[model samples]
Target: MDPLDSSISLGAASEAAAAKEDVESPDALLPWARFSAWLECVCVVTFDLELGQAIELVYPLDAKLTEKEKTSICYLAFPDSYSGCLGDTQFSFRLRHSVGRGNRGTWYEDGDLYNRDAPVPLQKEQSHLYGYVYFRQVKDGSVKRGYFQKSLVLVSRLPFPQLFRALLQVVAPEYFEKQEPCLEAVCNEIDQWPAPAPGQVLTLPVMGVVIQVRIPSSDDKPGDSPVTPSPKENLLPAPIILPSPHEQDLFQCFQSMLIHVQMLWELMLLGEPIVVMAPSPTMCSETVLALVSSISPLKYCCDFRPYFTIHDSEFKEYTTRTQAPPNVILGVTNPFFIKTFQFWPHIIRLGDVKMAGDLPKQVKVKKLAKLKSLDTKPGIYTAYKTFLHKDKMLIKRLLKGIQKKRPCEVQSALLRRHLLELTQSFIIPLERYLASLMPLQRSISPWKTPPQIRPFSQEEFISTLEHAGPQLTSVLKGDWLGLYRRFFRSHNFDGWYRLRLREMTHKVESLHLEVTCDADLLAWTIEKSEVEIVDLILKLREKLLRARKQQLGVGEQLLERLERSIHTVINSLPNDLQALLHRH
Candidate 1:
């Protein structure tokens, strides 16, 4: 199986005819008879490009090939009443020889010669030789003696230079159209843009590409240059000043974005995330459609995961099948996305800055603000309370709605799952909050007591027991406890709960009798009523005792201290232990 023989189509009846034509038409770009036979099988082919999008092409039998067969020319024609840009277009493309014995060679369209590797400049309502051609040999030689995979790239000639220039201006206005700009030049221009300081967002609207740019550090230079501090190092980056496109180009500027897909490809490769913002779903869709079809040399492109944050009506159609890869994204901007993701990408201004319009105004920076959870046990508790506080109204409403509903098993199950989801969502914050509190617990001074409290350890112990008791009981009784266990191992919960309870209990029993401060004792007594404190302790001890009975791995020392705390709190309560327990 010689690899060369497989693709060369040796010893075929049509080879002699093709070889003859090659001799006769040394410069007559005509398709080989053998290649023509292969083109007949090409129904249609489509490809999804990185920034631009999918290219749709149809190969007609009248296509022509160069004498070497490595390059070919074709009338890039779509069917009558065909879907995309309508016109008879000419494409000149290059073909790749096959690789392995079984491997088919691949080729993509070439960028516009006049446009200089920019988008293929197609003319509107007129026929023109624009776009590229591609073909591959197929192995199934049984039925159709020759079969080749074929594709075409055709775009409307809508004067894309205007939009390309606009994109350049939005990205770096001062250097707009100064000359053919490269990445390094653009970065330098960006370094001097009258844009907000780093971390602040700057919006740029070209045509299809809407950018929400975030300035990282004013001093952070993009290209390789020896670091030079600004004369006023203390000053922030200049405020964003959006450039107005020339009025003549402004009208067609939106459509011109279809021509500059190269800019996006370059931006993505820049190693920083590119945030593409759009004005509306309609605009986003139209822009993306124009982009995918207009990109030059549309073959041999990389895969892109396009994520659409469109309206509910369009979500099913535009949304990706899976989560977006960290690299790619295309959608509208909103606070939800801004707050949800920890990192922000550098912006790509599409048409003009004003295109973002009121969309940016809708972003409530203060309302969407979030602070990382504090580190400390109390901090954890505080965070837990914060999470609950934020959602308390919703939880109450859900519970109330559940109460009003007829007790159907399915409905009840759904309500239960809803509660579980709500609870699970905030558990991370709680865990983080608790983890932060550990150091504070360790840092408490053993020799000194706070002015208005019992021993620090004892107060913390009582607080832990009170908080842990209800949670443990809820877990034991809730039908959805399995959901909690699935994410948090049972041993983890038990160990965390046990440690806090044990520490608190140890401090309480080891209290010094050095005339305990009356004011501090009185304040402590008011903060935690004897009866309520006793009840909570008893409940925790009961849960621990049950765990011990079931061999759920309760530590012996932890259990003993819990029991002692229960007895001591019970003795201090208003009524005797039996009466207090029964009433509670």
Candidate 2:
């Protein structure tokens, strides 16, 4: 059978199965519901000598974009070194935008209304749009610049670097050859993709290529399950591929700095401002992504610019020496940044990938002056001290594995698993402590408003470290209390705490409504005075009004039942009391 035909057949089968599932289960998300969920739009960015980077085209014509957004997309898509570059380059960057504006309607206006997991509108709305750009520079005598420079960009909310890269591999070449019509066909193919339902194995056919992947679930843990088939097992032509943090080779990028892995992890956790200096945009972006994702499952709350250049809007804001550098990680190829970001506390300089040999270069810590020197070595330059001690045994094991000629994949897996475990070990204690802080579900009263979550206290959390902490289960140990103390001052802790608190508050609110709906109103009112009964009725009415106003997913039947229950209690009261309540 022709490969394209096979892919088409597979897609049809999957769609039929999905439709059947939707019929059987009314809650199933519709196809293309999250089409914009992963990919929002495809943009073509070109570099003009006078205009710099300019937006050549944006697919789907109706993709709402602001002037500022277009400018950002242009610059990000075409890297700083585009003028001097000769070949192809691929990299990713995060584009910040106002949440409710710019391509948001593409997702929300569709069947996305049926998506229960849609993000709730935020008061101060800001969001990051990840851009995966494939840039190319080819010889062209027709143009005055002597070379043609343009970039094909994939704008998405998802951070699936590998998936997007694969997509670009198909879309970019054809689009460059056939232009806008090629993009139109690609978009049509993409429209056929199923909703990105987590934990399900999806065989997505994009541009005649059948790619299979298992979207990681919220509960998925690193090293807990095998995402790929084992070597001994038969490999399918379209095997289910596990998503990666980024498309870059993490092991290769960080091989030189293997010894400083723990310190780097600590710095990332604390949201310290660090700069990565590499030989190219590819290396810079890859290293930065790898560092940020070191603490897997714990989302890095701080901002990171994978390939930051002097032309970026925020360049001045970040480089202002009058104030301390903000908590962000920047990756750059130009050596000029070394002088500009000299005030930055931590900087990691990576060696040229081409010059790398079988043995990885040993990393060393250097002073500011040494870093500034033209002949300075590639290593970590930082004044930051880690609260936790290094895991000598783990490092020895990894080094031994490398010496024993282990596969690069195996070594990378071992490192990633270790980092994940380390992060989980640190987070588990906080999670347990936070769980204890929740007001007991039974304590939620129907007569009164839900209780607020207890404020997080650093001292209180620390006191429990003796009985319940990472030390209890973690193989790596040191001054955990001290680490937690410092962590309380970091942005990661603040972000994590706020998110957890909001979720808990929502949970409590949901529980309160359920209790109110199922409350034994008549029985409770039996011993209550007229004043008390009236107050309870008023509270219940307020809750109902609030639920409706907020669209809290409360069913009409549930609200009506509660209303009937309230009326029943009121009718049972004395005539004069009832009349008084009615008038009020």
Candidate 3:
């Protein structure tokens, strides 16, 4: 389109869409021709251009257009109805070919279009667009004589300027949705703005396309440059402001963003065909539409626009534009342009931009996240309580030791604490609470509520004869113990008094064995309890008594010593042995 084509300009919003002359391609279009065949399958079609959008084209078979006018008309690429628009939209279009309803075979009008499966003759309205061709006249050179208005009714729905952002989001999904975000905070000294330093370049990823940019050299250099001592060597290369991967892509994304904005600017009441000035060539109209269409703003209120563009010139030198101010972005002079177009495209190297490493003394920075954790059970946090006060010792002695010995101990990943109350396995506790709810006299404890776990009833508890949690588990295997404990918690304990008594006897026998020889050795070697002295003293007293009372006749003095010793032992306890024996 010419820079200022009146037709390309947007007409009054109230004015109806322009009537496009119906023209067909230049060629013999038989009833069963290729063009007609393609048309047969064209459920929808549209012509799009950067200039504007068009819809509802009425083509008359006899209608014709001049060559210049035909060439200027935008290309309608697809077919679809105009459901709606974002806001004030501009469209320049012409309908060239169309076929309406009312065909002879398998033809259904309006609601019945879905049932058509066979070819049929088309009605006048059904055959709205004429299948015609364009060719230069052999003699008169009259542009209008080439093809009559073909019976084609083409309708296109151009996006409203307001939807420009949405359109880009739809069309070029990768660029808009996936562009890298830019970096911030070069210094606390000044609000972040583009630095105008030489040799400053940063890598950027736009929609995945990567580029290195240099801050445009500032004829507007900052007042602050690193001070050199002793008139030292060369000034340090001016800091090149670089973008994180996200920032690079963000910059590229900004280009599309501009196009989107320009389109909306029109709808926003800044009516004008969006002009994108960059060193690169203009994009095809279809491409522009594609970029816009990728985003579906019809749903989300915010999205990307495809038609937006920033500066048209490649950053060949320090350029200034009110649209983009150095105060807004640190202009980096591109170095790749100096080498060749193919090698160093879209790259700028700034040498004087402020160094991000340099920080201001005034502002405070907060720490980011403390880091990672891995726990499968939601709320069961790792509880390793130690009496040790030193963290270093705890880590070295406990954590490291456990890791070394238990290679399969829940890997480092599975160690997180849940901040919320645990609902899981609470059933285990709940069942216990519910079973205890029975009336005081008739409370029956279930012994096997959970199949894998058994709760220990009073009977089972008596069998252990010690602590239910620790001692009972010692008698049974892990699985049986789990079942016993679960059942004991859930089932009612009734009609098992005799079994309970027997279990108690077994517990007593077990305790008897524990105390005999084993308890003494265990207490001496492990627990170091002094209870072993009681049995030792009893045996010594028996040996001394037998020796003193032999048939040879024991001495009275020795007998007295023996009796005194026995009295001493008996006096140690509240009850005397003589009284205990007498009571029995």
Candidate 4:
């Protein structure tokens, strides 16, 4: 069992709450007896933006600057950033509380963990994660204005009494008995709140308002008085199988990133390797995993922990084998690996801040002077930083070509021909790419015998491409019922459901395109092909059509389920809320 399992377990609260309810209110049943009812109260919002937009949202600009300054600022500020932009604003926010520790467990002691010799790194501290968003005004320009915001603040670590009160406000059953009154009282009490001082005895009148409501006798039902259950209760919360709106948005963004990866992969086949740079390792891992998991058939296996493990021998010609998978490689920005694989194609540097052009270089002298004043070895680091800048420039050049407008005119026949050409040309060379990645040099070595690269022909490629349709179809035909059960069993939050649905959507769409195009391609190819090839294409086309229909049907069903779930939550709100809803 995982060590953090108890703390994070979805089952713990439900078990305790169920027991308490069985003893206290055996007759009353919640009108909507599901975990999602409670979860709907928590709001989650996310935004995505470009670097300039992010700077604009936070930075106080004197005037519109040249494009060069904007580029320089983006590169400078790229090192510490998160993935979300609200309009022209970039920010990350998450409200985390303890489920494992029962909403009051402090993960760390106040003073025990603090050290004078070595201060705790803010990133490592689970207690909080907050950062200021400010514009880089120019070289050596001081930040004109800045404000801090909390994104990953720990709520469970509040003082015990205050923590208990806050938890009761959200999770206590008694509080829900008179929700409108409680909400109004809470507002009035907050309005009258004074600034905290030493030995402050703050009290919330909302708690008193809730206490005034009569506790329903065992004879009453849930409708007479709405009782808020512990949010932790019930490992499986919602009856819905589809993702929430916010989750859907995030998933769509992820799919867009995957398409970029696919484009890069296609280009890599043409020997135009590119670099993908992100702000953090977590982002990098998430990107790779999301892409791989979307297509992987082994997604259902819970024990499977898929990750790329790059061996030292990957760069060494000391063996005639490869340890890692051929399709994808994960790389984090580190000195040793970066230097070794500097010449290797398709390098992805996570937490990479380097940018292309002389703008960054132009500011390097000013940067070096500051480092020197701070008693750092500026001379040693300058050359390394310059190399990074150059490498980033190479990446920038490659991406510029790829960002060009693609062929947008869509024709059923033309699209089919294009796919057929790709299968015939690109798929045929997949084996050579895999073979070249093996720990063997193309040139003969004097000391050791080099293993012969296995032969892979166009016949094999065509065969694989032909067989891939059915494999893809099978994968696309996902077990929605099984997924629903699995989701409930795992007790994961709504975010997990959102991501799963998003991936499912991506899988279905990719498969739909692949099969539809291939079927079309077969029609075009059959004119010049033999009877056997024509027969196979016809069979494959039928399978593809059926698969697409099934996927569409399932998608519709899932969407219906999601719509119903949202409506149920909205309808369950109190009379006052319903009036407010109508007013809005």
Q: How accurate is candidate 2 locally (lDDT)?
A: 0.75
Greater TM-score among 1 and 2 belongs to 2
lDDT for residue 508 in candidate 2, whole number 0-100: 82
The residue-by-residue lDDT of candidate 2 on 8-83, one tens digit each, is: 5655665676567668875455444335655777889997889878898887677767777787888777766633
Relative to the unseen true structure, what is the C-alpha lDDT of residue 38 in candidate 4, on a scale of 0 to 100?
A: 15
Q: lDDT: which candidate is best?
A: 2
Q: Please give, for residues 1-584, the per-residue lDDT of candidate 1 as tens digits.
A: 64223322322323454456568865323432222211221223322234211223223333332222211122221111111222222122112222221111111222212222222112111122122222222343543433322233221122222222334334322212231222223322222223222323444322123433332332333222223222233323432232211112211222223222223322322222333434332233333333322222121122221223322222343334355424333433332433233233333223222323222111111111232222111000001011112234433443344347533333333333433344333243334334434433433432244122232332343345434432542332232323333323333334344544454443332232111211132234346756656555554555554445433334566556555544554555566665856565
Worst 10 residues of 1 by lDDT: 376-385
* Rank order (by lDDT, best first): 2, 1, 4, 3
Using all chains and alpha carbons, the TM-scores for the candidates as numbered come to 0.19, 0.83, 0.15, 0.23
Local accuracy of candidate 3 as per-residue lDDT tens digits, 1-584: 53112211322110121111112433222221212221221111122334322322322222233332232232222111121222222221222222232221222242222112111111112312321111111222433343211111122111222222222222222212222111000011011112212334433222212223342222212222212213113324322222211111211212223212212211111111111112211122222232222221111111112212122122332233323211111111122222222221121111111222331111111111211121111110111211112223322333343435533222111110000011112122333433342233212221111112133344544344233233221221223334334333321122122233333433333233222212222233233222433453454355444433321133455545544554554445345544663253
TM-score, candidate 2, is 0.83
lDDT, candidate 2, at 412: 82
